[model samples]
Target: MESLVGLVVCSLLLAVQGLYSPSDDVVELNASNFNREVMQSDSLWLIEFYAPWCGHCQRLTPDWKKAATALKGVVKVGAVDADQHKSLGGQYGIRGFPTIKIFGANKNKPEDYQGGRTSQAIVEAALSGVRSLVKDRMAGKTGGSDHGWQSGGGGSGSKKDVVELTDDNFDQLVLDGEEVWLVEFFAPWCGHCKNLEPEWAAAATDIREQTKGKVRLGAVDATVHQGLSSRYGVRGFPTIKIFRKGEEPEDYSGGRSRSDIVSRALDLYSDNSPPPELLEIISEDTLKKTCEDYQLCIIAVLPHILDTGAAGRNGYLEVMMKMAEKYKKKMWGWLWTEAGAQMELESALGIGGFGYPAMAAINARKMKFALLKGSFSETGIHEFLRDLSMGRGSTATVGGGALPKIYTVQPWDGKDGELPTEDDIDLSDVELDDLERDEL
Candidate 1:
């Protein structure tokens, strides 16, 4: 009996290890085939909603891939990048990182499990939640979809819950001046945006509850924040985005849920301080060590040029300063040390261009980083510095022009919700008489 028991134990251990193999694990879903492949899939659907900048999403990818390949005949696994399909992510109210949604014809209700970025926990989700749903279907009880999985979240659409809001004091009322301004990208004519006003107000109000006047909430007419609406890629009705202190005014273009917006804001803005570390350059010796240790260096130009005499700069700077203070350990801010002459060092770092007024982001010494170009103002610089001190400089949007490429820190980002705002638009793109006549 003792010899037989030992054999059984070894066999079970092998099965667990076998489950970690990573062959044929993940699939990409786009606008054309989402419904056919997922919503209407014959087998169960386990979709991971994530953003590339989110570190948590990065770590989860490998573990999830392992789990996905292991499931094989048991379940179908897929992924949805919220940064690409803001609309889809919005539909799901996915606020943070590594949101795993399971779809099947059962009644599991897809409960959100905040296991973060752990390999075992993610795999276990399938073994416990998904597999259990499958078992229940084998029994007599019914009502799950033919491809029924489950739905998570309680609030969908809008409720009567409202807040007092208007255009006059809107910016001050909503934006708490975390120093950087995160505003909604919206057009007045959109029904979805209009319906979101109440919720948006409620979201801003909720932010003030704990922030104690640290951050500010506001919105802009995508009809006017310029080609900015296009650069940021506002393909949908309501989009929200984060404006680094001293950065240009870019509204959200990615399709994301209200809850996601609110939750992300609370998390990102939870600590309001300007970033000062970004303004100082690293010593030649320290720079070598940093390169060796991190293998990558990401630099942000920020809004040093455009925002100087502009409207949005002051607010953005405060945020950056706060970030600087927080990440003093691994961050350096490289701006033009001399104003009149071109900064050769910054230019060499960027290849024939000055790294002025842009976010220079690098990774693992892979030598790929982005120049977040926009305007900047002096006061905006002050505010931007304030936020950086607190150590947070990130925002995400999806479902339009590709999202800003950034890295994630954790395997699972946290959660919360956001409210949508309406933009007042000038119908210059269309003719009034023609609009009334109806081309159709």
Candidate 2:
């Protein structure tokens, strides 16, 4: 039994994004490869389960293709068009045009993208969501099943081939020989699906060079891959999944942009993804503005360098920070700052005059903060954060904790050659009454 358990664990590890056999390097997933394709995948998998009879899904065919091409290697990609297999579609609980679902390598429940049903948008959604899911799960957490938004897409089809992911060849799609596969699972009628059409196409074109062989992208219609979808537990549209060689899948949540989708695929260099922590970087302008206004106590510390022009400044800053923390309720609050270890030495007193290696205890706009320079140890970072949270040395802290801004863009009209109205409509030409071209 223990041996069996280990085997199961091993299997799960080997299947982050499942492998696939790309025959022509053109298109490999088809009705014939349905069952074997999905099941053999030991890693992450994004299967588009759809049906041909559904007018909406039929129209979204091209969008699916574009998604496939854009997210080739970072994940396993495949499609299971349901028309060819009626029972398969029903089993997957696909009661609509297109449905995208993702499977983690542990191979338990799959996350679903239940937004709008454009081929491009849905494919992108499924790939994006599944990647997050698989990544989170591998880290011992479930992210995809937690939260995500909806989307819209176009109601037309392009000259792209779409596949249906079915139970029969589901594993084959991932295990046949491809390194990574990112699949699109979507529904056609979803308004958001329609909106995502152009973005999907644009993504494919942009990443054409980056994805090539390392990635194999594809799609599926939830309306088709009944058993496969059911087994994976897809509950929505526009879901995404990433399949890798020897790890369980990393299914991501959120229906986002084409660039984001490409980023997931390229996280492995060349195509490359923005570093995970990059999202938390503070903008230089934002920082500068804050520094100028706040007379609050601020301390900047260097990681390695000492006994230089910056050294005195660093020590003074550190003392100042402690003093401020001690007198927080007494009108002496300080902000903390820190810099990377690689930064140059600082001044002995007053201003370090050193632009780099300045970090720890920063104050501005009533915000008392702590920063680390040069990738300080996680232990040190955590310790500082905990200290700040408790107002550690300070007797009291001003109450005010705001949630991080996690914005989402909603559905909109996406016609060819038409730009995003929100950003394009110029309020500069204000006529108010009879709108006419300004005769300037």
Candidate 3:
């Protein structure tokens, strides 16, 4: 039994190792030797960027090794463990696992390999790249220009979004600043740093536009600012770190694509923003201000105090508050009014026909509104808002194609409603005995 268990463990270990290690013909590339082994070589190269934890990368291991062995002397085949060496992978903008690139005569600008994952398909693509390189050489074109991939300052025409950081300004701009920053420490002469320049710049522009400068991107020249580099423990060509006020700097391990960086920046922005306030619609100004200030305004017409009382009404408000927190990233407005409090607003939104506890989403800019047909629970409201956000819900133009006339009203007093008392009539002066005598 002991021998059997040992054998099974050894087999499992072998299987795991096979996913990361290819055949001898395939060269293992890392941050230290990638530039020397592939970039400076005259031979055509095919490299795969992959993560060991990815199932797809493991499935492609056998075919990759076979193709490498077949093209041993003709073309160079290499693979990089992108998860382990993130700086190298970020330089190349490796967004997904099992991504392959073809490096031809123009080593700086590599073309993405879109062929099949089989050995035959990979070999054919590599051969085609080799033929194209030979033809270019025969035509006296070296194809070594750096303009193919590098763009000047985010491709935004002179207005750069990425800030330049130095030792003198790093503390003031990043550590003490009120905004979030994703800073890259890089050297000018490094090949990997050059590759990451365009991606970094583009991401900076997108993040700035999305967050309105609440989150920023910056870069520091590690070779020039040794003090800052050493402080951040920057030993690589391009190391990205996230900095927020009163927080410890953390390494950025996400993909280097523009979308990846933008996604992370937006998440940070949402975390820093407070949730939308749930306001009571007490006056015309309250209704107008909340609706016009946001892209979408969600209004809930809660049940009358006589019907739901304080506890039931509070339950409904709690649901709305949770929904508001869930979609706070959308930056929408949340408002509520008691039933019959705003008759004009209800008529314009067509809310009374559906009874109390109804909801509607209004787009003030477009003058359109969509009513919720689902229950008032959390799951129901979530589905309703999700569909509306995706443009799946039916919408109608607001009545008269404009905001309805709002009326000023007193706010809810947070108590059960009471019936008005009737005045007692003084009928004691009437003579009931005289009427009885007349009848007799």
Q: What is the C-alpha lDDT profile of model 3 across 1-440, one tens digit per residue?
A: 12354345434433453344543688998766776687668999999998774678888988999999999999999998886666556556676788999988766567899999999999999988889888999999787643212233223321267788888899999999999999988887788878777557766766786678999999888888899999989989799999989999999998665546766787888888778999999887888898888878999999988899899999999999999999998789999999988888898888887787999999886677888888999999999999876545566668788888877878788787887889998768869997689899
Residue 248, candidate 2: alpha-carbon lDDT: 68
Model 2 per-residue lDDT tens digits across residues 1-440: 12354345434433333122343121334433533455335555666666543445546556656566666665565666554443344334454556776655433245675665554665567566666766777898632221111122322222131223445666886646445766666666666554554444434433444445465545555666656556556677666676665666657653345445555545532322221110111333333433443333334443322333454444544444444443333232233333332122112111233344343544443333333323333344445545544434222111242212222222112212223367567777676553554543
TM-scores of all models? Answer: 0.32, 0.26, 0.55
lDDT for model 3: 0.81
Query: Local distance difference test, per candidate?
Result: 0.48, 0.44, 0.81
Candidate 1 local lDDT, residue 437: 90
Clashes of each: 119, 147, 0
Model 3 lDDT, residue 414, Cα: 79
Of 2 and 3, the candidate ranking higher by lDDT:
3
Backbone clashes in model 3, listed as residue pairs: none
Candidate 2 wrong stretches, greater than 4 Å: 1-169, 269-440
